[model samples]
Target: MNGRPVRVVENLNHALHESMLADSRLYVLGEDIADPYGGAFKATRGLSQANPDRVITTPISENGIVGVAAGLAMAGDAAIVEIMFGDFAGLAFDQLLNFASKSVSMYGRPHPMRLVVRCPSGGSRGYGPTHSQTLLKHFIGIPGLSLFEMSPFHDNRAVLAHMLGLGEPCVFIEDKVLYTRRMAGDGQVDDLFDYGFLGAGDTAPAHVYTEAHGDVDCLIIAPGGMAERALAAMRDLLLRHEISCRLVVPSRLYPVETDALLDAARHAAHVCVVEESTAGGTWGAEVAHVLHERLWGRLRRPVRLVHSADSVIPTAVHLEREILVQADTIVEAVLADLRGEGSPV
Candidate 1:
C-alpha cells in the first residue's frame, strides 16, 4: 500500500472532511471546532470552512453537547461530537451511558444511535491532571458503545470512514501526543505489525509484530499510544535479553477483539498487558483477567499488567514522566517476568 506521509492530526482531519463529503447526514459539533481556533488540538482545521452548515461550535457543556448529538442521531442524522479532552467525558457520562448507549437496545426497533464521540485522550505535553487523563476505561463497559484508539501504524482514515457507516455509538479516542507524530508509514519503513482481522468476524483488526512463522516467548498487548513504548521495549528485550516477543496493538479498546489475542497467547511463554490509564479497575485489568481465565491452564506464567500510577498525573514534566509508563519501565517488567523473578500463574 503506497501510503503518503500523514501525521495523526492530519489523518483525523482528512477522515472528518472525507466523511462529511461522502454523507449528507454527517455533522461535526464541539467547542472551539470552527475555523481560526479549529479545535483544542486543531483536528477540525478546515472542516468549518468546508461545511459551514454542519461544522458547529457549541458552548462549554459536554452533557448538553452530547445530549444534542444524541437527539440528532435519534432523528436520523450522524453526528460527530468532540469532547475536547478525555477528562471531560465525566460531564457527559449520563448522556452517553444512559441514552446513547441503550437507545438501540431499549427500543425493539433498531434506533441506530449513529453518534461518534471524538475524545482527545492520553497525557503528554504536561497538560495537567484535569486535561490529560486516559479515561477511556470509564466507558469500556457500556453495553452498546464501541470504543477505538488510533494507532500510528494503522490507516485511521479508512477506519474512521468505516465507523461512520456502522450506525453505532462509538468513542473514537485520539491521543494528544500522537497528533504531532508522523504516522509510521512513508514508503520507507515497513509497518511494525501485520494488520488483519482476528477471526471470522468483522471485529477490530489485530496486529502481529515480530517473527511471522515462529512462536513468540512473550505476547505484549497494548493500546495504540502505549504500543509505541511497548515496541521499544520489545526491541530492547530481543536485543538485550534475547527474548523473542510478539506485540499486538489493538485499534478497538472496548469489546476487545480477543480471537488474535488468545491465539497469540496460546503460543507465548508469557503474556503482558500495558495501558496508559491508571491501574486498578482499568481496561488492561479486564484484559488480564480474560487472558488468565481462558489460558490459565495452558499459560506458562501469570499475565502481568503494566499501567500508569493510580494517582493524579502531575503537571511537572519530570514528575509526569515518573508517573507515566515508559519504554524502560515496560522493559523491566517484561525482563523480570521472563527471568522467573516474578510470580507465575
Candidate 2:
C-alpha cells in the first residue's frame, strides 16, 4: 500500500480537515465515524481525533442522522452526516426529503444552515442489491440540495474541497468499488470524494494528469465506476497501435459542470460518454446532448455510449461484467470513432 506508483489522491481528506479547521461551526456526525473505529469506510478516519467536540458519532439511525443534521443546519452549523450506503438512506427519506431538502424553501428559513451528508454507494464488491443501488436518480427531483458523486481517485480531493466551500446542503456519494483500484498491479488507495483533479500519491496536486497516449483523436468521459476499464483500454490501444487519447473522469458525477467537459472536448475531435448507470435517462446522455448543443460541429465523430444494460446488476461476477462496460469494448468503441467507422450523425 506504500512506495508504489498510485493515483492516490488524499485531497478529500485534506478538504475535510481543512474545512473543519477553518470553521469551528462545522460538525460531522454519523455511524461508525468516531475515534478508534475510524469509519465504515475510513473516509471519516482521524476526523474525530482532530475535531473532537465537533465530530460526534450517532447511533445506528439514518433517520436520526438526517433529522439531526437538518436541525443543526437550521441552527447555522455546517453539519456533515454520513450514511453507510446509498440504499440504506431510503429509511431517512422522510427526514431528508420532507425536512433537509425542503425546509429552506418550505419554511423560508433565513440562514439555511448547510449540511454535507456523505455515503458510499454502488456495486462491484458482490455486496448485493442492498448496497448496490446508485440511487442518485431518486434525489434528482429534490430541489434545493446539492448532489455530488465522486468516481475517480484523481478528482476526489479537488471536488470535495469545492463542495465543502459551497456552503450548501450536499449529498456526497463515494463508491465502494474504487477503494482499491490498481495503478500498476502493485498498490492502491481509497477513492474518496475528490473531483475534477488528480492526486500523485502524497505529492502536490496534479492538473488533469493521465497516461493515455496515441495519435490523440477522441475524448472519453468515464465517471467513477467505469474509469479503470476506460484507462486500461487507452493503455492497451497505445500499446497496440500508438493512438493518442484523452479521458475525462468527472469526480463529481451528479449535478455536472458542463464548462470543464466542453473545454476538454475542445481538443478532442471525437467524444464518448461512459457510465455504469443505465443509458435510459442517465447523466451521460445529458453530457453528450450538452456537448452537441454547446459545441456543435466541434466534434469530428459521434458520441458513443458505454454503459450498463438497462437492468439491475446480476449476482454472478461474470454476469455482472457482461452487462457492464468492458476495457475491450471501450477500446473497440474508441477505435471505431478514430477510424471513422462509428455513426457520424
Output the lDDT of residue 201, model 1: 35
Q: For model 1, state the Cα shift of residue 313 in Å.
A: 0.7
Q: Which residue ranges in model 2 land beyond 4 Å of their true spot? A: 1-15, 49-52, 93-98, 103-112, 151-158, 181-215, 300-302, 336-345
Per-residue CA lDDT of model 2 for 1-345, tens digit only, reads: 576544322445566777788789888888888878877777677898899999988888899888888798888777878897878878887877778777667664544648877867777766664667666655654666777766544445456556656555678766677655433221222231112333333221211224322324677787665666776776777678676567676655556667777777787778888766666677777787788888886666657777666677777787777666678878877888778785433
* Tens digits of per-residue lDDT for model 1, 7-59: 88987789889889988988899999999899998999999998999998999
- What C-alpha lDDT does candidate 1 achieve relative to the native structure? 0.82
**Which residue segments of model 1 deviate by more than 4 Å?**
1-4, 186-203, 206-208, 343-345
TM-score of 2: 0.78
Clashing pairs in 1: 302-345
Task: Give me candidate 1's TM-score against the actual structure.
Answer: 0.93
Clashes of 1: 1
Candidate 2: RMSD over Cα atoms?
A: 5.4
How accurate locally, in lDDT, is each candidate?
0.82, 0.67
